[model samples]
Target chain A: MRFDVVGLGVSTVDLIFTVDELPGREVVQRAGESVIAGGGPVATALVTLARLGAATSMLDSIGSDFFGSFIQREFTAEGVDTGGLVVAQGRTTSKASILVRKSDGARAITFSPGDAPELTPDEVRVDIIRASKILHLNGRHWDACLHAARLAKEAGVLVSFDGGAHRYTNQHLSILPQVDICIAAHDYAAAFAGTEDVAQAAKALLEAGPCVVVVTQGAAGSRVFSKDGLDFQQQAHRVDRVVDTTGAGDAYHGAFLYGLARGFSLEASASFASAVAALNTRALGGRAALPSLAETEMFLQHPL
Target chain B: MRFDVVGLGVSTVDLIFTVDELPGREVVQRAGESVIAGGGPVATALVTLARLGAATSMLDSIGSDFFGSFIQREFTAEGVDTGGLVVAQGRTTSKASILVRKSDGARAITFSPGDAPELTPDEVRVDIIRASKILHLNGRHWDACLHAARLAKEAGVLVSFDGGAHRYTNQHLSILPQVDICIAAHDYAAAFAGTEDVAQAAKALLEAGPCVVVVTQGAAGSRVFSKDGLDFQQQAHRVDRVVDTTGAGDAYHGAFLYGLARGFSLEASASFASAVAALNTRALGGRAALPSLAETEMFLQHPL
Candidate 1:
């Protein structure tokens, strides 16, 4: 099936539990309840996009284990195309256990990516990228990701990299030049640019290779830099209750990609993305709390 | 095959991540490493029994999901018989995601038990319980557990219940009469006895029907009560480091059961269990850091 955007990276099974309060040393607290869901940056972003009425596809590998099947089923349920997903033998897919404190939306996470299967360039379906308007990646699988980005560029498709961190070695840095737009956490941007200021970090990042660079500064909002100069600073929509910040960044990326694919201007798209992200923090986990298009628009018109 | 002990309860796949410190608000920390292994009370106990050279079998249900398969694989790999395990159709099994804070071995856990399959008395192979010297239940399956306890009692097998919590309404009170030995946490004992003092809680629990009652008091050690009157108190072994307390209780229960199966005296078993538990807290997770028989014996001799 053809897609507007396809995401490539890890997908995981998340175990979430809620506690009344975080206890001190030697103190025990009773957990209220628990839930299981699909998690991971690219996977969650794709789910967010699909929920926002975008035709999304996920290209990743999962183990043949129970959590792997859980992830596959969730993707199917979310109406995401899993045609590109490969089930590996002799390994269990990634899993995360998250503890949410009730007083605040703070969470403690533990995860196991049990020998995550590697995807090579040969496995990248050129036709899929060729048909897509944008190819989004989450900064893993550097070699294959570079190949995919190269293929997308050749196919006249825009490529965006969700630079979560700089775990990539010098070898992986070679792929940065092929990326068109780079979006990342402020810390990641600072680390990449070797500067602490968001504006300076954004400029350094754009100079690194990408035509445009965006640094998300949590509640301080976001800043974008391009050759055309800095765009207007967008403030985050004030949220009444911050239930969770688990997938706020993923929501922003997904909504931004959705806006870009739908022909929205850079400023408008960033504002729209920020609204969706703020709305997501009102609930638990990442994807479960994503707002609908109507909700996002309403939030923009009459924000909390 | 004839067995020395049989465990009936829920088995889980644990996703464990170890971080250098507790993450602050909006702060992200890199994980040092991660490990995936089998978890849950009965699951760990059976694995411990198998490791201690006892023939063991786990009677439980798992979801047909990927996580279930992971749990099954772990049990089989550990040499615990899986013949009695039923895979529930169209159900996702229980999973736990745990974060181990490196600074203090403290852990935050999130768990999801999706449509846990139930084991019925009719599904029990009579000979398996009859041939066993002890039958252990973790109070996960209330009705089925009660039935199994009755069957074991009728066949002259000693029945033990690992009362993790007071989950089964008032119905669990009925099963208490059939239980020969009750091992539980201080909180659970308090809830069951309607009091906070561990010694008083044990006395009240003993009156509820079990011939013996043991209540673990975390770092304070444990209190034991019996029909023959209260036995000696067992103190917690001093450890230089306490890594993650995630499965320390389960380790204590497992080692305590192992001692009972080996015909150790009540006082000796409690001491052995305390030593094993202290050694387990020396690392992280349940089965991942389990001490060997020799290691536990040495710790018991050295008293730390």
Candidate 2:
């Protein structure tokens, strides 16, 4: 495979501000600190993989605006190839303004969905997907996602799906059959299965099509189930402090895929993935504190 | 005079998001609309003048970041010269993330003051200040503001001081004597005079050395007082809608200065300023709906 993993999703520029409290009325407050960074579920995941020494490629249509430039430059700086990235002229790129409370790490997000059109099915980079060991997606650019997943399946490339929280829908069920590995937030799993039971949700997800299924509940831990009858509960890794939890799930998905590519055992893969997610919370922005392979290994060894 | 007006103040990039209501806790809301615009007291004032067919220039130190580029581009597009604008290498430009309530145009602002160093007194463009018919300032880059005001006075240029609401300080007293025109928000005037009486505040401001003094009250109208004993209350112009009042005061300052430069009488100038300020509130951003000379004249004649 030319690349370890290829991702298709929306990319955005995130401007985060730290404030005393969320405003409930008219007022002007000073930010304690602020940082601007590139953000998106699958985009951040690909960045996580690249930081852990995996070669990854991203495919998406972005505007030619400042935010788009920011997103593209960030990918290049992180060693994530943008050969399949499309630039849409005279359009505004997606951006989000997130305000984080100072006393506690709660956030209020106001996102602007830019005017850039979504990628069409024909816009999918078939060659990139066919050349990758794994094709990861989160149902963004719905038609294109379905097209890319089918193409990856035909080429014998693994298909990974990430079901983010509050993003479950009936349309997602139609694409699950082609997904080889399915990892989802607890809310997504429960919503998809029409039940609150994690075990029942995992069982339903496994029966649908993925050979392996994992449902993650942040801070509590995650449960992994596979068709081969191998099952285990992975404890959440402990961190000295968690500055922000913005992209923790995305980090897990990326690190877990990295583990599978490296041929690690499923149990070891889950543990490594948990550590990577925990470590990502030590900084403000999603990609700011991504750990390298050496750093992750050293952290696992020290267990602190 | 080479230019009608020269401005010395901070310039910022404002990202305004219109939300259903202010967020008081952890929540992710979709913005009804979003706009990114260049903003500042004196910068907007100059842009207002430029839109009205006046030659204006801006002076300030800004970062070589995205927001800085935006500020510079906006000024150029509006026909405002930026020869005195300084670009500080490797610094972040000041920006504000404003969440505006959709029900009413109330807003909550969280600003990030960038790390760019302040423009020093020596950095003030002496030639630009000396050539302009009027030099305008609002105490930004304190030392530079003072230097510019003194140079404008020595060169026989009229000095205008904008006392924005919540922006008054005792240090401003030192620069007041050089000012020929002093326009202030009612709150600012009251703060300076240590009294809320409009007549008394205006009288006190005239005694502080300005030949003309005006105190503005939004929606209610503005009261103008002069050292020559001319006094009048100019009623605010009524607009079809008031989308946002972000830059109304600044617009008034620019149009008032424009009127003075065109040799209009004090009462006529105050009425023109009021009309321009009211018309500016017809759009979402400070500079979005700024009127040109033709638009302003048409609106004034129509009286709606």
Candidate 3:
């Protein structure tokens, strides 16, 4: 099947530990519940799109371990094309042991990046990129993300990026020119702009070549700056009880890209994206609770 | 190093998670704290012996995986010999994901016995067993435990056994007659003896060739039956706080064996073992809070 979006980044098997609250130093506590699932920025974004009626494909590598197989199987089970996934041998797949506090749905993520080999420029499949309407990347594998972004640019596919306060490296900065839409956490954008203000950071990132820039602040909402005269600020959608906030940002990216792929206006897409993100926290992990398109629409119409 | 105790059993790497309370079916909660440690009945028992100044050796086959390396390294660090350890190729070592509830210090353990091959009679190293004064077994490896137990009996070395409520397969019954010192959780002893009473379980097990039979009940203490005119009932040792209860039973076995090795009277050994087991729960995991012989004695004199 033709792909609506192609995602490139790492995937992790997260051991979701549910505890009442953080324990004291050296104090041993029991976990109320534990659920294991696949999680990662771009990976979860792909899952969101796939679950929302988009034909998505993931172009990434997971190490050769149970976690690797677990991640790959999750994608396949979710109807996300994993044909482009490379199983790197002799390495442990990256994983996270995430602690989710039940009282307020706060989470602490501890991630271990296994020695899965980085994707090389030569390994980027141009045919796959050309067939996709959007090339979404989680600016982690700098060299490979840049390579894919350039290929997507040449193929007339929109290049969307996810940078969650993790784009300080020179490698990440080097990919800015190829990014058509750059969405980042408020802190990451602020750090990049060398200012604490969101609007200032948006302008700085826009001048760097992205057609649109967004800075998302959890619970407070998000800010959008576009070269095409589309600028707005939106509040986060309120939910009665927040189960978990993990991967909410990734859901926003996936939904926003989905909107763009469906020809929605930038402002409309951002609003839809915000709705999707709020709904993502209704359950655990990133993709497990992602909203379907119909669900997103209903939420937008009547968000309680 | 000459070994006073040679332990043959499976080892596991446990991911200890702390949660406030168990979540409903699919609810996700965060963990307050998480700890990784080496655990398993015989493995922890050997560590206890080593810590109490006994020269201990482990004879087992663990898979060629990170968990295997972790378990082996932990034993080595604690002065338990790993030279007799065989690195089984193309397999994964056993592991457990333990959730500890802080409210009552209750724990739920989920164990995965990775494809680590069970030890065969041929794999039992007589030389190592001959060098040890005691041959300790966890009673899981049916063939290997029986082989080692027989060898120990022929060498006049005492064979100590550990059985939890988990001896499901009838294959476990074959190891009973070879065990000179049989210590088990109350439920397991009850099941094996076809009675719910602890005293009946202890009496029934005595007929199975064990010189001494002990049925341990958590928080309620333990019961001892022996052919050497040693029989008694001891109350549980009390601690101010119970951080975790994982491996407490293993601590008891190790300390009990240490007492017998040191020629302590059976009653004295049972009292010492209870003290050590209680101390084990003052911290996380089984091996972390194991006390030295001196400490156990001191605690007996004046328990805090």
Question: Residue A142's C-alpha lDDT in candidate 3?
Answer: 66
Which candidate's TM-score is highest?
2
Q: Give the per-residue lDDT digits (tens) of candidate 1, residues B1-304.
A: 8888889998887767787655433234446667667788888878877766778888888888777888888888778888888888888777665666676666655566667667877877677888788888877776678889999999999898887854425567988888888888887888887889877888888888899898888898988889789666889887788776667777788788889888899999898888877777766667766777887787777773
Candidate number achieving the greatest DockQ relative to the actual structure: 2
lDDT of 3 at B21: 66
lDDT of 3 by residue, B1-304 (tens): 4678999998877876677764323343556665568988899999988889999999888998667877887898899999778889978777666667778766655455677788888888899998889999977667888899999999989999887765645666787888889898888887888889877778878887798998899888998989765678977899888888888889999999999998998888889889999999988776778888788778899976
How many clashing residue pairs are found in candidate 1? 8
Query: Model 1 over residues A1-304: C-alpha lDDT tens digits?
Result: 6788988888987777776654323333445666677888898889888888999888887888767778888899898889888888877788765767777666656566767567778877777888788999966766678889899888888998897854534554676787788888887877777788888887777777788788888889888777578566888888898877888888889999998899998898899999988888876677777888888888889976
Candidate 2: list runs displaced more than 4 Å.
none
> How far out, in Å, is residue A142 in model 1?
3.3
Instruction: Estimate, for each residue in B83-138, the C-alpha lDDT of model 2 and write its tens digit.
Output: 99999999989999999898988899999999899999999989898889999999
C-alpha DockQ for predicted model 1: 0.18
Per-residue lDDT, model 1, residue B92, is 76
